[model samples]
Structures are given as C-alpha cells and as structure tokens.
Target chain A: MAGARRERDIHAATLELLTEVGYDGLTIEGVAARSGVNKTTIYRWWPSKDALLGSAMVEADVLAIRLPDTGSLRGDLESLLRQIAALLTGPDTSPVVTALLGAATHRPELGEVVRRFFADRLGRELPMFERAVRRGELRDGVDPATVMDLLAGAVWVRALLRGQPPRPAYVRETVDLVLRGCTS
Target chain B: MAGARRERDIHAATLELLTEVGYDGLTIEGVAARSGVNKTTIYRWWPSKDALLGSAMVEADVLAIRLPDTGSLRGDLESLLRQIAALLTGPDTSPVVTALLGAATHRPELGEVVRRFFADRLGRELPMFERAVRRGELRDGVDPATVMDLLAGAVWVRALLRGQPPRPAYVRETVDLVLRGCTS
Candidate 1:
C-alpha cells in the first residue's frame, strides 16, 4: 500500500511539473524534489526524463475514466465523450497532453507513450459499444475504429484544432448527430 | 511574374527543408541556400525563422485544396477527405505540418500562425456544405464545423494518433457513414 501510494504521488508530481514547466523545462530533479522521493530511488526505476514521464503517464490514476455500461449507445457515448473532454481539455491535464505530444513528435519513445495512452484510453472506451451491440442498438459488424474516429476525432479536433473548451451544448449535439448510426 | 515565381520557389524550399530537417533543424539560412533567395531579402520580407515558416505555410501552393461542388453532399465530402488525406499524409507536406505544430505548441506567436493556417484552410473547406445546404441535401443551418470535425478528425487521428496512413477505403466508408446526415 505504501509503495502504491508513493508511486501515485510520484506520478502526480511528474504531471504537476509537466504542467507548470512544459516538456523542456521538466527535470528528474524537479520531479524528485516535487514528489519528495529521493533521486536515487527515482533513477532505479526510470533512467531518463522520458522514462519517468512515460511511467507517470502510463501508470497515473489521473486517468480515472469510468466506463459505464449505460445499456444504450447514446448514454454510453455521452459518458465516454464527457469523460474524455474533461480529461483532455481540463486545465490540469490538457497542457500535459499538449506538451507530451510536442515532445513525442520528435522522440519515438515518447511517441510510444502517446500511442499507449490513447490505445489504453480508447480501448477502455470501445467496450461501451458492447452493450449497444447486445441490445441491438448498434449494427453488429460496425468497426469500432469508425465510431472512435467520429467521437474521439470530433473531441480532439474541437479541443486541439479549434482551441475551444468542451461545451455541453456541443457535446450533446455531437452525441445526437455524430452517433446517429454506428452502422457502416 | 518572376517575382511571384521567386516567392513560390521560396515557400516550396521552406517546406522541403522543414520536411527534411524538422522544426529545430529548419533555418532561414537553410531556406535561403535551398531556395537561392538572398538571406538579406528573406530577412527584409520576414524578420525571423517563425515569420518565414508562417509566411511559407500561409502562402504556399502545397495546400492546393479545390472544393469542387460535385452537386451532392456525399460527392463533396469524399472529395474533401481524399484531398486532405493526400495533402496532410502525402510524402512532402506531412512532416512540415507536423513540425510546425510541435513548434507552435509553446510559442504564442507561432500559435497564431497555426490558428490562421487552419482558419484559412478550414474556412475554404467550409463552403463545401454550401451546395448541400442550397440543394437541401443537408439540413438547413447545419453546423459546418461538425462536418469538418468528423472528417478532419478521422484523418488527423489516423495519421497522428494511430500512425496509420490514410486509406481510400477509410476515406470512402467514413464519407458514407460519418456524413450520413449533417442535420442535428
């Protein structure tokens, strides 16, 4: 329990540092000082700033996404999109994602972290369609990626490309219009 | 005609250098050497590297997106997606766009360039729905951003998040399903 708690603190501290300083300004020393974990202990598990940031991203409870089996496609999608918007556009994590993406564009290792982060998050979100399938709400053979492309794509473009904070009206309208048919 | 040709050549060279060496590697001197444009003249027109890059992006022939009024909603969308995937994922301009985005994340000045680039490009693309709206093929008052969001989001996410090159089948299937009805 103590080890688990300490790791969470370390991850939290890393994200906090990332948010405050951007990617280039982040240092393992800064993470150590912020987390109160000794530098030697931090280095034992992670050898580089990239390694530490990757671990923090992959292992963070900051991504507390709860996938609800809302028994219908619409409800599940709304839950999923709202959660994603909150996570990606929220003040705390938005800059962290942006900084990581900037750093990841240049570094393959950090790129893997970005890939894994999306894979994990989108993977968890994909199962929301299962209940819809079971209830005949969605077409049986619908490609999950298609649905993801529309929902996640809309969310990302709205946030990143347009630079708009997530709006409830936009989210609701998108859910209604974007998911009219998960059938292809 | 010679002056216009010279400017076009400069923008082309800037994109080539950007794709080859990336953002940090891109330099005004390199653009000058590549384009055969004098550094003093380049400096006279654009004060800094960011200015050069921004001008090159905004004023380039690289984004030759022709919004054809194919006389139907589906036809227009398919054309739009196909062209975007080709331009953004094509061998020449993809890395240039990627490098610019990474650099723009931190620098607010460069950030304005990115915003303008998209606003200009997307602004042009937005009128694709005009034919649909006029033809009564799409719902009246349909938000053009929604349509752009679904289409562009899929394209960008495939390239950026999933690391998959755009597929023709994807472009077609997404047009079929993603744009089923723009009315919300």
Candidate 2:
C-alpha cells in the first residue's frame, strides 16, 4: 500500500511537470525534486526520461473516454467527435497530447503507444459505424475502420497542425461528409 | 564569401543531423560537431534549436511543390494529391516533415512556421475546390475549403499515424468520397 501511494505521488508529480515544462523540457531531476522520490527509485521503475514521461502521460485523461450510443451513426459519430474535440481542447488532455505527439515522432515506441491508444479508442467507437454499414446505410466497400481514422485525422490536423479548435459544426460536417459522401 | 560558405555548410550539416538524430535527439552541440562549426556560430544564425531546425527544414524539399494548373477540379486535385503524396513519402522530405511536426508540438515559433507552411500549401490548393463549388460540382453549404481540409488531413493522418504510404487508390477514393457523397 505504501509503495502504491509513492508510485501515485510520483506519477502526479510527473504530470505536473509535463504540463509545466512539456516533454522536451521535462527532466528526471525535476521529477525527483517535485515528487520527493530519489532519482534512483524513478530510474528503477523507468529506464529513461521518455519512459517516465510516457508512464506519466498514461495517467492523464486520454483513456477515460467512453463511447456513446445514440442509436444512429450520425448521432453516435457526432457525439464521439464532440467528445474528442472537447478532450483536445480540454486543459488536462491538450498538453499531454501535444507532448506525446511530439515524442512519438522520434521515438517509435511512444509512437506505437500513441497509435495503439487511438486504435483502442477507435475500436470501441467504430462499432457505431459498423452498425450503420450493416444496416445498408453506407456505401459498399467503405471501410468502417478507415472512416474513424479519417475523422480523427481531420480533427487532429485541425487541432494540432492548424491550431484550430474542433468546432462542433466541423465535427458534424466531417461525419456527414464521410457517411453520406461529399457529393451533391 | 567565406562567411556565406560557412553558413551554407552549417545549414547543410544541420539538415543531415535532422535526418540522423531527428527533432528530439538533435542538439546544437551535435550540429556543431557535425558541421565543424563552433556552437556560437550555429547559435549566431539561429537563436534556439527550434529556430535552427526550422531554418534547416525550410531548406528541405517541401518548398518545391507548385499548385497545379490542370483544367478541372478533379484533375488538379488528383495531380496535387499525387504530388503531395510523393513529397510526403519522398525520402528527402519525409524525415524533415517528421522532424518539423514533432518540433511544432512544443515550439510555438516552429509551430507558426509549420502552420504557415500548411496554410500556404492548402491555401493555394483550396481554390481549385472552390472553382468546383462554383461549377456546381459540389453541394450547397459545403465549404470547399473544409472539404480540402478533410482530404488533406485524411492523407496526412494515414501517413503520420498509420505509417502507411498513401496509395493512389486511397487518394482516388478520398476524392470520390468528398466530391460524390457515399450514400447508396
């Protein structure tokens, strides 16, 4: 129980540092100072700064998302997208996401984790689209899985690349564009 | 003449390091060692690592793209997507892009440069879609620019996250989905 408490404390300290300093600027020394854990103990649990930061990032709010079921593809997608947009804009998740994305470029291991995190989330939410496909509401040969990637990629590009917030209307239109096709 | 030659050599060395070390592991010291330039000289041209990296990256192949003047929206877009996809997957540009994207996550200054890069690219390309809109090729209320975002974002997501090369077929389907609508 004492060990668990210490671990939680250290993780919390790391998260605090992440928000303050970002991934690139974060240091194990800072984590040690902030958490009151000896640097050796941190090194014992995590091999490198990247590992420690990655572990700390896992403690952030990214994985808590629950899929919504609104009984239709559009409604369900809209809800999921709204939640994602909200998360991207949310204070707790934004910096962590930004940091993780930064880390993933050079660190393929972290990149895999980020990819898996997205895949896992998409796994839960994609059934909504699958349902629509099964009901003949979508076009033939349209990949349900790829749709989520496109949706997410679009929103993330807007958020990360363009510095734009994922507007609710933008989410809706993106969903509509994917499901119904963008044609007249 | 000596100073100009030295500056060019430094930038070239930095570009090489950009590929070898990537954005995260890249350092001024490393650049100096690689370029045979003193650290102060590297810092003299660029104030920080991000700025130096941004300068190096801007000199990479990304600037070579020209918005095609092919007649018709589909033709122009297909050409653009193909060229963009080639640039994205192209060896010289890929590592530079990956590094720039990672840097943008943490460095606001670099982020602005990256944003301007995309805006310039997308800004030029979007008018092609607008011409389509005027020609009634797309539906009412659909912002040609937004559709352009979806298209570009979709391709970028696949490349960035999935590590999958953008297929010509995927580009075809994406263009079709955006322009034709997907509903049966």
Candidate 3:
C-alpha cells in the first residue's frame, strides 16, 4: 500500500516537473524535491531521468485515453479526435506531451517508449475500424493503422507544429476528409 | 568577404554541434570552440542559444528543400513528399530538425521560427495546388493550406511519433488518400 502511494507521488511529481520545466530541464533531483520522496527512492525505481519521465508521460497521456464507440465510423472518429484535441490542448497535458515528443527525437529509448505507447493506443482503437468495416462503412483491407496515423497526425501537426489549438471545426474537417477518402 | 566566410563557418559548426551534442547539450562556448569564432561574435549575431540553433536548423533543412513542380497534381505531391521523407530520414538533418522541434516546445521564439519556415514552404508550393485546380484536378474552392497541412501532418506523424521512416509506398498512399479526399 505504501509502495503504491509512493509510486503515485513520484509520478505526480514527475508530471508536474515535466509541465513546469519541460523534458530538457527536468531532473530526478527536481522530482524528488517536488514529491518529497528521497532521491534514492527514485533511483531505485527508475534507473534514469528519461525512464521516469517516459513512465510519467505514458501514465498521464496514454493510459487515461478511453476511445468512444458511437455506433458509426464518422461518429467514432469525430468523438475520438475531439477527445484527442482536448487532451493535446489541455493546460496540463500539452506541455508534457510536447516535451516527450521533443525528447524522443534525441533519445532512442524514449522514442521506443513513445512509439510503443502510441502503437498500444492505436491497437486498442483498432476495433472501431473493424466495426466500421462490418457496417460496410469502410472497404475491406483498409489499413486501420494508416488511417489512424493520418487522423492523429493531422491534429498533431496543427497542435504541435502549427502552434494552433485543434479546434472542433478542424477536427470535423479532418475526420470528414479521411472518411471520404477511406469510403471512396 | 571574410564576414560571409565566418558566417558559413559558424553555421556549419552549429549544425555539427547540434547533431553531436543536441540542443540541450549545445552551448555557445562549445560552438565558439568548434568554429574557432569568438563567443562574442555568436552573441552579436544570434542573441541566444535558441536563436542560433533555430537559424542553424532553418539553414540546414528549409533553404535546401526544392519542391518539384511535376505538372500533374499526383506527380507533384509524390515528388514533394518523397523529398520530405528523404530529408526527415537523412542522418545529418534529422537530428538537427528533431532537436529544433524539441527545443521549440519550451522556446516560443523557436516555435515561431519553425512555424514561419513551414508556412513559407507551403506558400511556395501553393502554386501546384492552384495549377491542379486550373486543370480541374481539384475543386475550385479547395483550401490549399488545409490540404498542405494534412499531407505534411501525415508524414510528420509517421516520422516523428511512430519512429518509422516515411517509406516510398507510405508516401504514395498518403498522396493518393489526400487526393481522393480532396477531390471527392
């Protein structure tokens, strides 16, 4: 019980530091100080600062996402994307996500962590596309992975590269565009 | 004459250090040492480390890209995206681009620089879309900027998030999908 509590405290502190200082500036010492956990405790759990930050990011962004199935491909996509937009633009989560993306570029292990995180998330969401195919909304052999990449990628570019909040209208347009392409 | 040579030497050193040490580890003193230029000269020109890095990235990536104007919309898009894929996967430029992107997250000025760089590149490529519209390859009212975002965003997601190189087949598929969506 105490161990679980300590882990949560460490994750919470790590996330706070990620948003506050970003990945480049984030350090294990800062997390320890912020969480009031001993530095040795952190080292025992996570061998390096990158490992800790990667875990914190996955815990914050990936684990918590629950994809909605709204009985139609368009509905499911729009709903899922809207949730994504909110998360990407969320006050607390956006910086953390951006920091991880930035860190992933320089660090190969962290890149794997991020890639695995998304791959798992996309895997979880695969059923939505399968359902769409069953409903005759999508053609057979349509690669759900590619479609997911396009949809999510479109939003990510806007949010991260363009520095624009993923507005609802933009999300709708992206969904409509991808759906049109997939269906046709 | 000497001033131009010094500037080139500094930029070359900056790019080299960016790939070697990354944005977080790169320091003005290090750049000075690598280029054999005075630290004061770097400060005189760039104002900050972020500024120098941003400039180096732009000089490396943007100024070098040449968008192909292949007459057909499909041809133009495929060629352009292929170039993007090569650049993103290129050993020398990829790290610098990634570091700049990561640095841009915490540094607003660098973000603006990246944004402006893409915006300008998109602007240069808008003529291709316009030509396609003239040839009835696309609808009259299609927004070039939005289409550009979707295309570039799809590639960026794969390259950055998925840790996958944008393969030629993937690039072709993206172009076809976007074209299908945009036309229909």
Top candidate (DockQ): 2
Q: What digit string (tens of lDDT, one per residue) describes model 2 on residues A19-133?
A: 7886667788999999999988888888887667656545444436667777777788788878878777788778767776777787776666665555666667767767877
Candidate 3 has a DockQ of: 0.39
Q: How do the residues B63-178 of candidate 1 rate in per-residue lDDT, one tens digit apiece?
A: 66777788777888888889888876787767776777677666657776676676877778767766666676675545777777878888888878777777888898777666
RMSD of each: 3.6, 5.7, 4.3
Worst 10-residue stretch by lDDT in candidate 3 chain B?
B54-63
Clashes of each: 0, 6, 0
Q: Provide the TM-score for each candidate, comma-separated.
A: 0.85, 0.74, 0.81
Per-residue lDDT of candidate 1, residues A31-123 (tens digit)? 889999998898888889877887888788776777877777777878878987887788767777777777777666667667777777667
lDDT of 3 by residue, B58-113 (tens): 55433367867777889998898888777777876676677677777777767777
In candidate 1 the C-alpha lDDT for residue A72 amounts to: 72
lDDT of 3 at A163: 77
TM-score between predicted and true chain B, model 3: 0.80
CAPRI-style grade of the A/B interface in model 3: acceptable
> Candidate 2 overall Cα lDDT vs. reference?
0.72
List fnat, each candidate.
0.35, 0.66, 0.50
Q: Identify the superior model by lDDT, candidate 1 or candidate 2.
A: 1
Better of 1 and 2 by TM-score: 1
